[model samples]
Target: MLTKRLVTALLTAVTCTITTAAAVPAQAAASTAIPVPSTGEHLMPAGGVFEAGTAWKLDVRNAPLHANSAGMVKTVADQTAALYGGVAAFNAYQYSTSFYTVPADQPRVDVQWDNCQGKNYTPPGLLGPEGQFTQVPIPADAVPAKGTDSQLTVYSPSTDQLWEFWVTKKTADGSWSACWGGRIDGVSQSDGFFLDGFGASASGLSLAGGTIGIEDVRSGVIDHALALHMSAPGTWQEFSYPAQRSDGFDTSVNRVPEGTRLRLDPSVDVDALKMHPIAKMVAKAAQKYGFIVTDKAGCTAVVAESPQAEIAATGVDPWKQLMGSTPSYSIMKNFPWGQLQALPRDYAKRTVAPATPSTDPGTSPTAPTAVSTRYVSDTTFRTVRNGWGPVEKDRSNGESAAGDGRGLKIAGVSYAKGLGVHASSEVIVPVEGAKTFSAQVGVDGEVGTNGSVVFQVWNGATKLADSGTLRGGQAAKTLTADVTGASEIRLVVTDSGNGSAKDHADWANAKLLTPVATTTTAPTITAPTTTAPTAVSTRYVSDTTFRTVRNGWGPVEKDRSNGESAAGDGRGLKIAGVSYAKGLGVHASSEVIVPVEGAKTFSAQVGVDGEVGTNGSVVFQVWNGATKLADSGTLRGGQAAKTLTADVTGASEIRLVVTDSGNGRTADHADWADAKLLG
Candidate 1:
């Protein structure tokens, strides 16, 4: 679905920001200038089939459509003579097309699209990653509501899916009237989505947002050149793209047939020309990586990047000054059309074929096996099962809602939580066997409330919690309930006073955390409470004796003995970072087995390495399998030694475990010096 240049976005790297633009070029000689090849993953020139930045495709679209001093093709002149009898047809009217934009504040929609049956040719395969689209919405303000021009582009970070629409018409019922479309997998370099040797209007790989974007202009530099279009000289029905012939069009002769490639003769120096700055940019691009034919448009015209994004990228308005009166069109009208040459119809450059990778075009990225907890969005009711109403539009007061897992935010009142104002929604708890229910509540929307709102959690008739009389200004109170054994949970919000008055509430970042269950079976045998008769005050064991501790540090670490072997105090055991029982992020653990008899207490000193900003912490605890006996609070990377002791009245197996306070193994270097089991 992601057609690079077909719809929106600029022609620059996806993440580059704007900087002072460079001046017009007197670039090094063509042979000396840094070559910017089109064959790389930067999808451009419609016929290309690469992903963003990997270097996969090298077909007719990216490779020099036809080698200049190397390859040959059926010249545009030869074909024109066989059809319209020559230059008359070439000089026939041709004009560039303009794109309109929708303001950024419009509501985005999950497009409902259908094929323009019988009108546009249907290829054997589908376009784009093969997934049944449900939440597939158009990118914010993807198209101008009134712009009759149908080409469109859409991307959903939530699903990592991008869609391209062509010859489109949006019906009032929220369905698409499209002549044709294609979809591509964003991650996989090559996918099952089909491609025709004869490229379509949006045939260029970079139709959707790719390397070159309007953002590049804002940065004052066009990293790449533009992709333009031309007509096949004759009405010849033999189409080069997915579909060569369609209903209502005359099939007469072959002219600038679909998929034809053209480039400015390398001999013509763009740097030597004196046209508008914009026109010069376009010409130089043609000389190097020329544009390919995508669609039949208002003559031999080149479409620029998304107009909306072009303006927004700058955060200023230089559109008119940069584009000029006719958007550089008047200037291009005089470009060297005669110097252009076309690439062969079906071109491929491979001497030895390699085994192609297997692909599954129809599957959604394997959905993470549903864990116990889930964040049920306030929009869709599919997961709620009961008590959700149609989405409402309330912009003014609701707390601005955060985008979903995908970085997408809609306009209007975002935090207006409810099924049509004072409404309710129910979601199954995260942990199926969880013994607790937890969530955050806030009257976050615009606070037009002298009126109040009540948040209640219920499992059938048994009420768990009631956040009473909450107003917008006093929101974000946390609520907890022991909802043990309940099959499902329901969260209800009711108006405390008069019918709901601007009670846009919020349920933010709620999670149902479940710890790994450990074996609680008491030990069969017990060790002495204190060291054997000759305990000799104390004999210590390194944490490495009981369990595997951190091998070293950093992912690249390999030498285990390199780190501090003992704590700074030099009395007890030393180990790597601390981590939870299972693992937090990195793997870290410390434990020791020692014979003891009536050992009264266990104490030690712990902290991360003495580095500032190391982001490490440790939790030293004495445990008996799943049960925790003593904790050393939380020690930071460089906090002063804090003494901790746990009474081991009738304990046999005394084990120590250091857990990472936050992320695993960043600054986790712990020591249990000055530690012993006092008898």
Candidate 2:
């Protein structure tokens, strides 16, 4: 639904630069720097991409609404309902923009101008009659936004320059070209707009401006206004202040002009709305910084930083965990649309008062420091398992027994205190109220660049950190996890798909931070004891209904093997060639809670079901509330089932849990064969 002028502008060169202006002082500094995978790659700087006074960075929670705010809200609401089934949505994975930051030392290559669409247009400044090109430092793996737009942005913090391209692509000869694009210099000092009518957006605004980044969502607070695309905008010549031009076509009196800012009613109780966590985040931002009409689209949509590039680089999709089961199109379904208050045209031109400086010293608080530290090697473990001999303290795990190992060494660095264990090992420690756990982990140098392993930390069902596939002699990775309020901590090591030969892994300089205990005297009274229950006839779990069930992949099947995702899709529950007619079939990362009615014992034979052959690996555990009663260490497919028995006396509910063995849950069909309760 974009106008003809906007579509045609993509076929020519567009160069933009910032106008000199007084810079605003930054309000606050970022506490922690975001970790970069490579040395030269950079993300948005501490405060943000541009100066503090830019329209996108201004705090407008108390801004006044226009006289015609109600009419504008009705226009947008009607169009939204017609286009998006009654609600505006965020374009997260597709039809959005992505950006990359590179260092000055990166290779500079010329991006040629392509007239691929056969449109008549003259090349702008910087691209002369000789077809000269400006060199850009783009990373090799950099990818543009997916879909038709193919928009890509590259920024250099060291140079304070930004380049954006539309319909961008790499040609067959490995050279880059775009139908149209622009470059901006002195980005940090700019007013968050393009000059000389050059930019990727139809309104001459920066593509990166107002776009929501992943970190903003993860932190549950967005500090800037959001960029919005609407189907109908005012006439092409009628635009607001931060926009140099507009591509609007609608001449209806109700059409909102380009650059018009609209916000949800500040009086609305956003938290009280039945909205998803992601929607609540957007709603709060809508009430605070509001939404700026930026471009034209088929439906009302908000811009989000495309997640494809990050997913490709890290092999992890953060949205999957952040949004959970909510689909992108419905993330904003519950947002309050009728209450939007449109600001007056040219809202950014209004004079605003500066923030008052704090006078009280107690207003700002520093980050808390560790109260006390204790070496994990000195702590007694509730459970410990090693692939080789015994777990060693203050040493590298030698192939034989305890105290037979050498000094704890990783990547040539020696440590005086730590725990050393082989792969396929687990060590559980009770750290009920610890602050944090930290360690320098790697495949120990004692292995001499031969073995590979992974280190992980878990607090119950939630995994805190993972060091993916560290090889011998590699630089040790610093692993730190927040364990506050966790009853127990699990430190696990697993072979990196290879056999566990020579996989000597070390948790060098491992320690826990905790508040020092305070002692007080108190009187106590003894209580009477009751008789233990006698064993009676067993009741098969398959014959009883579970109080609750949660699975990572498929639904929990009763008395059948976990085959696929559909209900009743599995065969008989089998492990190690033995079939069981009475049991429950489930996927890894599963939990089934059953009411025991004061049962004395819960027993099961747990293993990866034979239906998956040797493709799956898992660990089985039994829990009564937060207390773990039994655990079957890592079991793989084709392995004999391990018999598990737990004392469930006086317990009303018993939890059967299965988790992937330190790896991801893939083909992890697990069986609890002959599971029963006896009293």
Candidate 3:
């Protein structure tokens, strides 16, 4: 129950702009001073006449309330409540037109009876034929009443169908008001009271149905009605109408204000919900809305991550969770969503390229005074090491081929002369400030005896950290260093003191990797080291030539069905299918890379124009040669985009390969765009 003052305050808050506020009071004063309408000569039509400045009030209520929760209070009394459950709002309706003429001597007023019960009440009732009117005899002693509910006798002067209404006195001023009462069961509504509000028209009404229509007396406009079918609970729906109907009571004119968030049902599926225009927008930004799962205890809901609490509180997915009646974000008019940036990568170094490569003599592979193809024995080489391995050599290469010509090779200079290791010996290569380092090294021939290897981080010429021994020969050895900030690092083979007769020392894949950097700035693509890429035959693929190409910049790599070669400069490779391939889509461990400075996030945009296959994705990843920098998972043309970020230390090769997940579906035709590395 609300008091008049409370209702007034609520109304003021809800409707701030109403013109002519004091007009109602002033008009009421003037209307109270006028004579009653009993003596008027002309009578207006039943549904369309106005009793100026007069006000009518009605109270409607519904019965019975059951408390669903333990502490909730009961409000509704029993079935005795006036309104069955109907909400208060006036409605006026037109029945039939008729006229009433009052005689001068009787000092009477003409009151027309318009059957407000719509078409249901036939001619026998007040909705009778023409020449009939409901004329109410006013008491001479009544004090110029502006509102009265006295029964009236009406007379109609026309032959057309006549209507009836309990017409009241006219206010001195022009405005008029009317109210109606109807009961509805099971519906909930406020205890409504109306001092001044008019009713209007309706639709889907017929004389055969039990629908009633009420109209504004002054304007003869049908204002409101009671639809008997809506008397049952849950049978009626609330609707807002904005325009003036025949009854003149058009109530739904206000627009929804800003900061209004409508919550929709949570059970909706994404694809199905997209059919609705609003739902589609929310799905597009699902990532921006994260969900935090928790139990009643306010703990991390995960079993092992944190201790399980009795009451875990977590954030629900805002986009999926409905807050009120609609699924919409309550964004302020000035809020900025378009200005935020997306981040994808996790590394900082640029690309993956070897520190130096085997090249033609007269070429400055290291300190190039000129360019030339130079051949030197393996004895004069230094090995580049992987900063990550346990060396995992037993898996691929046998013990004999382990550490064989597989480590990093620094071209041009002879390690034999630079660091002074005996031909049959090994020494430590030092890298300073390196917390840890890993590398793969190879011994060209056999190391029958004195097979020894040393790895260390160095400051220029001093060894800061070292790995004491390495089993030699074609085997690969992994080395890690914990020292930090070393200006120079080397992996040296001291004395092959065992003298196993291993001749040359060769190194291939080397990684000088560092931890992921923390920065917000996005990385930019550098101008390529080579001229604009030109299509070339496979025979010319050299370390120098390959180093110049940008990752994700080459031609599309279509799946093998097109007979496209994967061995060339990596031009024209398109993915025929995409699914869960072993290294990328299939397994979480697989990675891809993009050539850019610093750590960057990588996304694979798989384009599928309705094609199908199991090998439909192109994995855009960066790697320090054999070591992966970063990798993203399977992306279908249907899915279109997926992103993963990794850290890169220096120049690295980014490889996109499509491996079939073996789903055996006609692989989807997938195209890939260059990877976008976000910050």
Candidate 4:
């Protein structure tokens, strides 16, 4: 019987294999630019690793083979069968390399030398003139490759530098350390080797140069040479040109040397083989750029970027989606190992022509549309899961099927557009390039102050914003999140610690703000002017029912502070211990439109109400027909009120608005104290 540890290892290995072969989005393959999940940056330039004419990037189909090509191929096949139970396979998650790309702004930290492996070679100096250990821009969430080797690689396109580490691990002090590693400068211009004889691999080859990238497989094309690890390599210390050093221990004379390129026979038709899609892709690449013996490992295998780190950073598993039901171990089982030919050491060194540079910028070719506002009610969601009735659009969640719901209302306030869902519900929306997602959320009034639920927004596994527990009939809370670079957005509603009873939730006026390209144009400046009131007449805004109101939470209140749940349950408007007898009380994201009635000015003292203490933050603005106005920057509860005065001369109407200060509207009860108009 297999031990528990062994069974777990086997299961993990199988899972890694399946994930490694999974497919990527079709758009990812069509676009040469592949995003790094860790930093949302492009993996590398369009050419895919190494300089144009470098050996790793060379097309070796027509290259000459060694005189003992047949003998070398047989040796490799025999060694592979002996080590891997008669078939070669791809090393995916375990004993594999994982690479990451960081942007210019990534934080830099020093990597200490742990010397855990006790290797003999001297570690290379840092990118700067510093000693062996130096600062590298490794993401805080960076994960080393699985297995004992723990190989990790990082590239910074902004600096054109590459860093590789072995036995990488985090220290007790929350810093990083590695057993051995090397740094390469001018990576785009140098040969694909660690010149200082220091690297994660025994052969001193740059992992970034030959490792198969996810995009390469997604595109169905491997343009560069693939990295091959052999359990038996020629001579303990002997290596070929392009390989600066070697740790090969096999002394057999017929063993393949490190850096020896091997290619699939060009005469064979790879497309006709009974092979997995991933295997076919590997074969095509082998027939083109071939494979370079770069390292010695437990088994003879090809190396691809481990999907573990990418999956950790992003909840989506690209490999599982890419390979479907194809088992990873069987990917290369049908490969034509017998027909492989070993090329001469350092073959085509001076003959292979340099590849032409790509004109692409390594980004999506199609430009996104201009930035615009879109409502969630107008868009189709990917999936919807609800605890009770089906998710309803533009209405409150009722007990049964679609269209059985009523109007969406919270705290006696109605919404023209929104999503109605029951507790323990999830609505997933695909928003690849959206800039921001915003929504007003609360328990639907249909629950009538009964249910308690929490609203949350998520981008993959990362939670963007969350609303605290809210009861039915309470003023709605506003949620806004920066969703740039996210592939999808999840709107989730869950019961607040209790059992799901009447937990009908409403996401009112939910919308997305997407970015678009803008052309440069000359700026237009207008002169500022002030209009004086011709007559003195004042009227309080709270006394008028003729005004139109839109509140984030509950209904706009008269002469009081916005309270929790039900309407007409508010207290007197007060801020920082100061009380106002007459004022308009509203929630954050509230808007009030009143007829100007020849009023030349509008004045109000705005602040987050003291009733909720310091729990709320909001910004107050007064608009005069889209003209000159006054704005009270960001105000928090328990703070002094900010006095606002706006010139409304020649304006048909004036608008008073309160918005959450970039934070979720948890307790955003705002007051327009002493709000009045003068003519």
How much lDDT does candidate 2 score? Answer: 0.69
**Span of 10 residues, lowest total lDDT, candidate 4:** 1-10
Q: Per-residue CA lDDT of candidate 2, range 1-679, in tens?
A: 1223221122111101111220211111122333222111222321235533356655567776776788889988887777534656567665566777664466888887776544222333435432224778777778887767787888764466888777878888888887766777876445566644456777777778777766566545665677888777765545665665566768776778778888989899987887766677777888877888888766677777776666766665655555665555556665778889888666655222122122222121211121356778889874467998888888889877668888876654556678889988999977856776777677776788788899999988899878777777554555667688898899999999999999999987687766443333677845547765543867777667685478976678776676555444455577887777668889989999988877789999999887566778999999999999999999997899999999999888889999898998887889999899898
For all predicted structures, in order, the TM-scores are 0.35, 0.47, 0.19, 0.47
Write down the worst ten-residue block by lDDT for model 3: 299-308
lDDT digits (tens) for residues 1-679 of candidate 3: 0001111132222211123232222111111121111112122211111111000000001111111211110111110022312111111101111123222123333333333333221222121232122233222222121112211112221111222222233344422211111111110111111101111112111111111111012111221211211111110111111110111111221111110111112233444431222223222222222111100111001011000010111222211221122211111111112221211110011122223222212111111111111111212334343322212221211133333323222111111111212233332333323333333333422233223444444545666444344434222332333335654454544434554333334332233333332234678856679886543221111111122232222222221112111111111222322321101111111223334444234344443322222234433344566776554444553454444444433544454444333442233333433233333
lDDT of 1 at 456: 78
lDDT of 1 by residue, 110-224 (tens): 4444543321212222322342223334433334211234455543322334455555565776554454444544422232122321112333333432222322332233323
* Model 4 ranges off by over 4 Å: 1-47, 119-128, 349-679
Distance (Å) between predicted and true CA of 165, model 2?
A: 1.1
* RMSD in Å for model 1: 28.6
Q: Write down the lDDT of every candidate, Cα atoms only.
A: 0.38, 0.69, 0.24, 0.69
Tens-place lDDT per residue, model 4, 388-410, is 97899898889878798988766
